[model samples]
Target chain A: MSEFLRFVSHQIEDFAMQVTFNPVEGTGTVVYNLSLVRVEDLEQTISVFRATCEAGVSPSSLIRILYAGEELDGFVIPQNFCGILTLCSTTLDGLLLQRGIPSNPIGGGVIEVAENIPKRFTHLIKYEYTTIDPLQVLVSQEITSVHQVMKHGNGSILGNIRECHMEAEDDVEEVLDELTEGYFTGILDLGLPNTPCLGVAVDPQYMGLAALGGTNWMAALREEGISVTMQAMKGLCDISTMEFVSQL
Target chain B: MSEFLRFVSHQIEDFAMQVTFNPVEGTGTVVYNLSLVRVEDLEQTISVFRATCEAGVSPSSLIRILYAGEELDGFVIPQNFCGILTLCSTTLDGLLLQRGIPSNPIGGGVIEVAENIPKRFTHLIKYEYTTIDPLQVLVSQEITSVHQVMKHGNGSILGNIRECHMEAEDDVEEVLDELTEGYFTGILDLGLPNTPCLGVAVDPQYMGLAALGGTNWMAALREEGISVTMQAMKGLCDISTMEFVSQL
Candidate 1:
């Protein structure tokens, strides 16, 4: 923990100011960049996660650490434990992959919403042609109006679209049902076979699906004038080590 | 025709320069904005069509005037004639309406293409929320790379998506088949029930369809440094008065 704090201090000066030794007060928070995790080095992953939390991307109340497969309630890493974490952008990809369903990551963009219903995508950048995560790019550019949507029920927010084979429709539905039952917040809309979702077109023989971007919260935080560091689809860590913000 | 010429001269100056009064050379070109046509006023529609053509939106050879319904091969309007002219954006809307298939115009966008195939949309704007036609907006902004698409089979071009009742699938397919048989260049893609046609989403129980925008030619011309004035979906006129560029 001291080493992690030292690392956070080296990376960001303000992180130390936000950290509180009291775990019960929830001032200590950790965010794992799901895309950046190195599974082979669980120790490094843990260190990075801790360092990020210490970096104070958000108030502890707003930090969200989710376990994908099974829920374990604790902040401490259990020895020999392994599990998956989910970010909204890559949650469905991970889920479908676990079920052996091939899914393709397509594009990420800003989805405009009105009265809490998605109206259309106002901007899009295709995944194939971009070097960075499109959502991250949009967020960093400060182009998203997520805070307005949250406050007024109308504005633009981050989302992503992807497609899977037509044959996986039933399986996809089943997964969606499970996610819904689990109260997942990532899903935005799913298209029929060969259809578009959220006004975006899909390839023939494939169905498009959209999810709220994982960095949406980060955008919202940034919109609120809070500083945040996000690593989207970073990598993996044991679910056992995660503590939900609510629990914290 | 003199009165129409007067109207055209008042609306644009260069249109007179392009009018060679040579039928064989195809210098006399007219484009009718299908949406702006007050069906009750056929003479006025003709006047507007002629005026727009005379405004020099395109070169004589590149001018395309499409008849939506039954074909009539003539450049003169039969007395008391009533017929439909199709712009790519309004063509499907008219066809589906004729068949009692309730269709909704959803959006207009710039679709990126690679190797003669659509990859994804780099930009989109929903129709329900905008006053101006999205394609026209994108084209007038000089943002489309249609010339590149035409020359290299990769670039961005104009397209629009719409949705219709799922029950109208057969009717829509029949219309598509007929259009295909007629060698239509407007049809871009069609989605399965409740799917998006080109990466745009549709409502539940509706299917999405997309067509190349009629303004695509204008964009291509503009990309090559041609200044073109466009009035998309402007109105309608008798199909008999239309002359295909090849026929001319």
Candidate 2:
């Protein structure tokens, strides 16, 4: 509706079609962005998890993650530890190699595309959190819907979410336990550390949920007016670290 | 149980006469220090929320607040927004002021209390989200209990829950929008922001829960082994602002 998106260098595909054919927030937003991806001929979606799991990397290097591909921006690492009395959040390689079933990273809703973003890469990307247990680091961060982000000022609530994941990966578990697990019973954005090195990558990519479950969760969220996008996590897949990243 | 309480220079008086007790923490934490009030210590219990709402001073200001007398702590800077918001947390006060009325300001059953220290002053006091919507300034925050804090941090969850006032406030339109409310659907602390501030409070005062039901909610939380505290907003109330503050 606003010319601001155009001024921001974003494309405006079917404004009338959105207003006419679709009138819902989630549906409309996804259609608009999908149109952009279609016109631009950009790779719509990529299974970063599957690619990352295939790449076998080392934990110490803390670099060269599996989902290192094009159009993928970030990732959500949810690991709960039973040993070391630590908040234990290891790298992708460590997890895939040791964690539960490689395909069930999200536990309940596997095989579906991760949803939090809407149009592909635009300006910024976000990662949203739902539940995170400290005793185990068990997580419930589903990027499958735009509702989570749009409800709060576009992608405002999730902006910090991805950052905390990327930058605070090192101190995330310990600090998360201290900052969250201890006193706070309420849940909002897991207040990960606020440091330069501690941030998440938000690539403006697309993963169509239409093929997965008739609709993409992130696209649905965008229809609700959430400002978000996808990332390039599957690009780093190098085959060796495939099993290792899943267990971490 | 441990000698940790010895250094605070304060003694729990309720242990003598009534053993004021109220078990807090559904399983985690919320604003603490306020839990220092015991169930039997009606005067102090009433004063904690009174201070938070009326004075707009956090729990850290308690030592001096008590010394300054209730009136001074209750004083506001003429239409002070914080003072107004504090006063708006009057639902519980109605129940407190009118005994024999089955209602709980601190919450239904689950109460939470976190340790209170001089340092955690700014962190340990969270009022529910009442001041919003009905008044649209800040959400009305109440002296919440452990169950309420952990289950639905912002108290917005109460929008759908009418434990005491069910059927009285029931409306078809309201219930249908429950999904969009997104208030009570996820982890209380990590879900929707209750109001304006983050529900993260840390007190280094060394004060623990004294009693529950009538005792301070803080003491109740410690027994649950939660080291942190944060309470979000919930439902609505019908009481004078001051009355609500006094009761909460």
Candidate 3:
């Protein structure tokens, strides 16, 4: 009775994603892509997206894009905004890597920057994770403000992500937390554009009990010892949906 | 025991990744970022990765650098080649989506042909999926091949792939016969690039237990039926190291 079961027969691993860019600084436009790909054969299951968002001016206009969140097409920023984003790169943790200037690039490493986080736009991002496979398939999402830069101009925008946020409701988190038997964790983030860059160390392992009910790829990963996996939302922005499905 | 186990007390889905490119005909380069985000607090985890690869007329030329991999970084071409790549993209499924196409702009989509593809190169990617919590954290990557304007550069690299005859060893079709369980499918693919773009659906019930040892996440999902995700090499060209990883 699930949408996937009714439509998709081959269960390998498939994912579809879309990203829309709202250029508030340079151009008021929305840029997004909807794509799907199969993990086993690198088959492009789907690929398409739309981006709209006009360009804006000023650093505040740039930082406002952090709210784009991966799920929404676009959002408008307050015409009157005042804030300064200390733009630069600083290694937070991990090895002396490019950004991993600190041990493990995937193990708690990041780029840090602080902006005048707006009050109305400051939405709490509570993330939840589920492993689709050991190395490749996993889903971790939430509602948060994600900021990004455009290739054209020297500015950025704040993105208000609601679709992913809605997916990770308070109830969903509760279920996953109890399912994982308390190994679940929620961190308080300060970085505006928080992204996760991780490597698939092992093959993917889908978790969850189907006979019980319909659970998604993420919900199935809990039984294993995996509670939390790093997130990297940068590669996902404005890409064709096929990109995600091909990785499955 | 394992290098990551010492401080890896808490159960976590850890990861790392590398993307390399070698443009043969025209010019090809890949740009990407690595990231890490927290599951609970979406704001905490952040990371980035940026890299590029351009195929020299041969293999080694201007800036000589040595790294990993079997074949030397210099000119090395085999009789035939094959590869198995595992990646998840927003549009791997090949859904026709209308992304904001720029009017009087530079270009759109990753369909750029550099009029070339270096002799060959392959990357193996894997991720251990979590059972619950779906997160979409990503890093964008671009692979631009500057060929001889083969078809005015607007053609798709995935339009030509048909069989697995490009490998250095066994054909992928033969490998399919080796598996009795799991599902196989070929929905989309990149012909010239030698990428499959296929899918591998699994029941998880049987595969989760057998492949994951005793800790299969599928144990939790009794029967709704699930997918056991994996990737296979597409190119006939074989690299010893890559072959080992693909078998998993």
Best by TM-score: 1
Residue lDDT tens for model 3, B1-248 = 11222211111111101112221211112111111212221211100000011111111111111122314323232222211121212111111111111111000112222334312111111122112111122111112222222224222121111122233112222332322221111122222222322221222121100010010111111111221121111111111122111122
In order, the Cα lDDT scores of the candidates are 0.52, 0.20, 0.18
- Stretches off by above 4 angstroms in model 3 are A1-89, A93-102, A107-248, B1-248
Ranking by TM-score: 1, 2, 3
The window of 10 residues in a row where model 2 chain B has the poorest summed lDDT is B7-16
Per residue, candidate 2 scores C-alpha lDDT tens digits across B67-167 of 11233223422221111121112222222122222222211112222332111111110112111111111111222333333334321111111112222
Q: What is each candidate's DockQ, to 2 decimals?
A: 0.01, 0.01, 0.02
Q: Model 2, A1-248: lDDT tens per residue?
A: 21111111011111211221111111111111110122111111122222211321101111122211223224332222010000011112122222221111110111111233221221111111111111011011223333333333233111111222333344434433432322111112222233211122222221111001111322343343332232211122222322222344
Largest DockQ belongs to which candidate? 3
Q: What is the lDDT of residue B15 in candidate 3?
A: 13
Task: Name the regions of candidate 1 deviating beyond 4 angstroms.
Answer: A1-248, B1-31, B34-88
Pick the winner on DockQ between candidates 2 and 3.
Answer: 3
Interface RMSD (Å), every candidate: 19.3, 20.6, 14.8
Model 3 lDDT tens row, A151-233: 23221122211111222234333432332221111112212212211111211221111010001111222222223221122
Ranking according to DockQ, highest score first: 3, 1, 2
